[model samples]
Target: MKTALFELADQVLFQNYGKRDLALVRGEGVYLYDDQGKRYLDFTAGIAVCNLGHAHPGVTDVIERQARQLLHVSNLFLIEGQVALAEKLTQLAQRGGEAYRAMFVNTGTEANEGALKLARRYQYVNGHAEKTRVVALPNSFHGRTMGSLSVTSNPKYREGMTPLVPGFEVAETYEQAVEMLDDRTAACIVEVVQGEAGVRPVDEDLLRRLAARAKELGALLIVDEVQTGVGRTGRFFGYEHFGLSPDIITMAKGLGNGIPVGAILAKQKVADAFTPGLHGSTFGGNPFAMAVANYVVEVVRDPGFLERVRQVGEALRTVLEAHFERVTGLGLMWGFDVEDAASWRKRAAERGLLVTVCGPKRIRLVPPLILEEAHVQEFEAIVTQMSRA
Candidate 1:
């Protein structure tokens, strides 16, 4: 029993996204309700954006209050909310005694795009105008924007979009990526945990090498934390897990829970290169987005809140480890191997659970940060039944 809305959606909308047959109409806590009123335990969390969960009361209140107080204004004015959020992010980003500064955008792609510009600009201002090449690791997923796509390593993501931004190149292998960093390199970008690579954590030894080499070569070290920031990895930022203080950071996925807000954080020395007219966004830091993002940062940055996430994430990990092979990830973000992932996802949905298929054989689990130990038990039960089936 499907609705005409699903049919209409296929008819009118761009079919860029491969969608499931189930049509979710509403959500609350960790559950989604379809038009037919079947309840589903939501483990995907809207692809990791709803870090706080669905229809969160606090987030709803902020949205409503901001809607009444002020919705949007041009970036021309000084937005107190944006300033407050920037201060919070930069403070959280401070590492090894070097403070950071931040700027807002609307998505992860935009954040990375701006970070790239800042990287080249920082070098140009410092008399290294030829340092314009960016080196990216193999199997990295930054975003779909032209600039971010150029730095992204997956060849499949670039199909039908070749001749990408020149000077942007992916290293032949992960080892070669760091080896390629040099004086001519403007920046080298990486993901601490390569999410799309089946949730593989980048090799720490190589990461350390990359950081050291970037410093030695005067190339900026940029960590793409869009999918791993905002306490997703049980640390304020994923790079914190490795004790690497990156020169620039791009984040977006979980920052505002489900609201669209992204940011670029840079060491002040590098940030200074972007003068008044260097880069700008029209609706980047509107009052509405800032208000929600500020609140999300406040809640996720709490020490106690993050500790609970670590505990619960481990509990969930134990369950996945027992049943699935190659279960890996950090904090609440995890990926496991399965046979026929699409079919497995559909079967799980039939039993009232929902998950994401990151690849043909890789299933990624990015449940909300608010997920409790009891939720793990519930997930185990559903998995047990699926195994029996």
Candidate 2:
């Protein structure tokens, strides 16, 4: 039966998310409870944003304490939480003890947009005003905004939004992406793993070449870690797996566990282009978000915690490989090919397992970072039950 909430939502809300049937009213650990009080084993952790799992106690405590202490404050004055969080991020993001800086925003898209701007600003400020174009990879997903969208390659996203921000283009092929880097290019943005494109891993050799070519051509390399940062890939940043150095890194999902927050961590030399008056956000680095994110990083960046993620991720990958075809991904993130993806997801949901369909025959699993081996066994049983029918 359709709930009154759906009916009321139809009357009042925008229909951007398409037709919906499930309405989760509560969450704890890796489970979600619907309005009808049915329990579900969630494999999609809010599309990779809830890495610490739903309703994490540590995040809740930070939110409560921060809310009571101080919530909103303008960027006019110094924010201690932001400073502390930045220190942790720069430390975790250390590259041979090189200095790095960060700018916080509310979403991953914003982080990308800011990073792109920083790239161009760095070039322009250095007297290379002609270097304004950006090169993005094919099948990459950045954000919904204009600046980020310009570099995003999916035609479905840019269907009618022509005349996008000037000088931004997607290379037709990964090899061409390297060739496209030149004096006119401001930066080359890429994702370590194309999570939105069915959790496909980008070509490592091509990426290394891209980074090398961009550096040779005086263009910056930006790694968009939106879906892969904060332990989603069993590492603090997905780029760590590649062993390639990037000038700027954009991340948002899983940073605050649940609270909306994003940031751009760049090498100090490149980030310094954004002077005091260049860019600013009113609510980006507020104390509340800073506190929650600080707590999340402190927990996720622990060597023991990350090692656990790597071990469990390998176990989960084994289970997926055994049960499904073309299973690909790292850490807690994974994708597999199955017939009738929509129906398969529906069956899983009906059986109290939650998954997301990313393509016609692709289903993605981005379970919480804290997922245990027992959860994998539970997931196996559910899939086994569905496969029989």
Candidate 3:
């Protein structure tokens, strides 16, 4: 019966994801249930896409209200929610909650697509069209789209998709990245916390060095905050924790708290790169996405919200480190070394815990920001058994 349903799904939809056999029916707080009512402590949190937790009342309410009132309006027409969401997001980025323009898109990949375009066009308009090389780090996962795929450094994902956008370079070290930066480089994109790269956090000194070098070479420093922004790393923006300002920032995952929305925030001067007729999207910044994003940003940017995430993250890490030899991460986004990740994942699933595996030796724990102590303890117990096994 399960195999039939899975087969039907595969036949209808293009098989990209290795869809787990379980079918999730509903979610509340930090738990998800399958069709047969088997509950699992949801530590993966939709791969860190549900920061506010599942079925959050506030986010759901906004979606419902916006759906009833007005769902989508074309970019040609001005919408209140679009303007409001942009303002809120900008305020969340700026220190005093000041004005900064935002260009919305449908997904993180789309946001990076727009950002790359903006960076290239910005340099072109300023008489540096040759500044089109993009430098990204090894083990980086930007997005699946063509432009983003070019800078993405994973060969596994890039294997068949060859002859990708030319002028893409991969840097192994900060010094190597700096060497790749020159007058011809359009932008250098880096994830604050390398989410798909085994939850690796960039060294602080490297981040500062990259920013300074990007400024020196006239290439825009594009911070891909898709997985690390909106309080995921215990800061409004992950770069805030490192004390550096990026020329451009792109985000999506948790911006809508489960709804699809992506945005690019740039410095006013650099943002001016694109003019009226230069770029746009049909469903970008529609009412539904905007309303949801507005609510998420307000809640995530609150003073106490991220502090709670940090506190819980430290506590969880302490428990996790005791079980595993190495634990790496910033906030709730953490990964630990496991002897047999596949077996551990299977055991956790059998024991009613939902998680994700990273590489062969790592287990990732990207729970919702609102996970309680009880949930943490429960997850800790499950992981401890794996350690002894």
Please name the candidate that would achieve the greatest lDDT relative to the true structure.
Answer: 2
TM-score of 2: 0.99
Report every candidate's CA lDDT: 0.91, 0.92, 0.85
Sort all candidates by lDDT, best to worst: 2, 1, 3
* Preferred candidate (TM-score higher): 2 or 3: 2
Q: Which stretches of candidate 2 lie over 4 Å from their true place?
A: none
lDDT of 2 by residue, 259-364 (tens): 9899999999998899999998889989999999999999999999999999999999999999999999988889999999999999999999999998889999
Whole-structure CA lDDT of model 2:
0.92
Query: Which pairs clash inside model 2?
Result: none
RMSD from true fold, candidate 2: 0.9
TM-score of each: 0.98, 0.99, 0.96
**By descending TM-score, how would the candidates be arranged?**
2, 1, 3
Evaluated against the true structure, the overall lDDT of model 1 is 0.91
Query: What number of clashing residue pairs does each candidate have, in the order they appear?
Result: 0, 0, 0
- Runs in model 3 lying further than 4 Å from the true structure: 1-3, 96-99
lDDT of 3: 0.85
Clashes of 2: 0
Cα shift from native, residue 65, model 1 (Å): 0.7
